[model samples]
Target: MVKTKVITIASVSGGGKTAVTEELRKRLSTSEALYFDEYDFEGAPDDLVKWVEEGPDYNQWNLEPLKADLESFLEREEPPAYIIIDYPFSYKNDKLKDFIDLSIYIATPLDIAMARRILREHLKKTSIEINDELDYYLKFGRVAYLEMENAIKLNSDFIVAGTLKVIDIVDAILNKIETL
Candidate 1:
């Protein structure tokens, strides 16, 4: 039996991973794209906002749960021919890394991400206070960017831009998968 192919689009908070993943979902006729943010939380008292604020480590507190849920989902459904996950995958999760067939890292410059965050805060009418939560995310973003660079060094595919063109990245990954 052929194993299902899983493609993950991962990056920092404002790296356009969702945009790329959504475009990939639309472009691929046979694939089902899953957004980790939309996954059910199963009555967890704290919401994502709380999780982002109080989590011990980014992966242990936030990303690990998502990875576990995703792994369970994959096992239960066994999914469509191709599965694309739109989430930031921390390098700490080796099990999650092992499950993916291809990982695409989307990277934008730190300055660009900061600008995007400011714009997002303004649009949402939220305070621009640099609290622990903001600091944690900022640090995570920096670490994620560095990890993505290492992933590229390890031959993972990547797209770097303030504004990414998803179609091009999706097409390239699809073509590579077809040839493999």
Candidate 2:
């Protein structure tokens, strides 16, 4: 059996990972798509800054389920030909790094990333809730993103600008897959 191709798209918060992942999903109709943020919550304390600074892992999201899901899919007689995961933290997760066939990072400036996060929060969360989350991003998210950005950049096969035309990245991936 041909093994499944796993593509991980990593980026800092609000760095266009979801938007690009959506486009990839539309284009890769046969592939499976995983959204990390869907599992981003685990009922942790409301204070995210303290959570991060006080020895709590910033990436507290449950990923073992996603790993298990991927394993079960791969075990199937007919698994998806490709799997696309919109996730970050390749440098922090050994298992994630091992699972990736292709790694892509959506590069965005920190200022733009934080701005997008604020905009996204305004659309989704209550003002009071958004303030707390924004505080977390400002206090902890920036440091974490910088660390992740540097590590994943060294580990990625392609680093594309978040503002780049999607067709270009999609075409690039498709072309590479054809060669492989």
Candidate 3:
């Protein structure tokens, strides 16, 4: 079976990874996309702090099924042209190393990420709750992002500024793919 071209768009929360992935989906033909945030893990806690600090073991994720799902796609009669994963944890997953043809890091700074996260998440939350959320993110999310940044940078094939317009990022990636 021919191997599918797998791409990972990784960044911390509110880093515009979703925007880039959405743009990619719209622009790419015959593409299958996966969002890590959408994954349903049986024993996973809703608590972000515990999930981040406890690391991979304590955080339950049904990723084995994803591996199989990806394999199924690759083995198909006409395999998908691309598989894009918009998630932060790809750096830590060795299983994906062989599958991923390219890794793109959306390098959004911490302050920008915080602003975006607060803006996106504050809709249903009260002001006080939003403050608490920011605090929690500052304490735990920042730590997790910091810990993962170096590894992600080293693994990435391309580093794009996360603050750029999604269309620009899309154009950059499309051009890069054409060259490749």
Q: Per-prediction count of colliding residue pairs?
A: 0, 0, 0
Q: Write down the TM-score of every candidate.
A: 0.63, 0.75, 0.84
lDDT of 3 by residue, 52-84 (tens): 666644225546656677788788889988888
TM-score of 2: 0.75
Residues 103-179 of candidate 1 have per-residue lDDT tens digits of 77666666666666667655645354545446766655455455444544244454444354667666766676686
Top-lDDT candidate index: 3
- In lDDT terms, how accurate is model 2? 0.73
> Which 10 consecutive residues of model 1 have the lowest summed lDDT?
53-62
lDDT of candidate 2 over 1-180, digit per residue (tens)? 677888888888778777777778778757888887776445434764455456555345446767887787778878988888888765356546678888888788777888887886678778788888778776666666766566666667878876666677666666666765
Evaluation by lDDT, superior candidate among 2 and 3? 3
| Ordered list by TM-score, greatest first | 3, 2, 1
lDDT of 3: 0.76
Which scores higher on lDDT, 1 or 2? 2
Q: How big is the positional error of residue 97 in model 1, measured in Å on the Cα after superposition?
A: 1.9
In candidate 1, stretches whose alpha carbon ends up further than 4 angstroms from where it belongs are 39-78, 124-163
> Could you arrange the candidates by lDDT from highest to lowest?
3, 2, 1
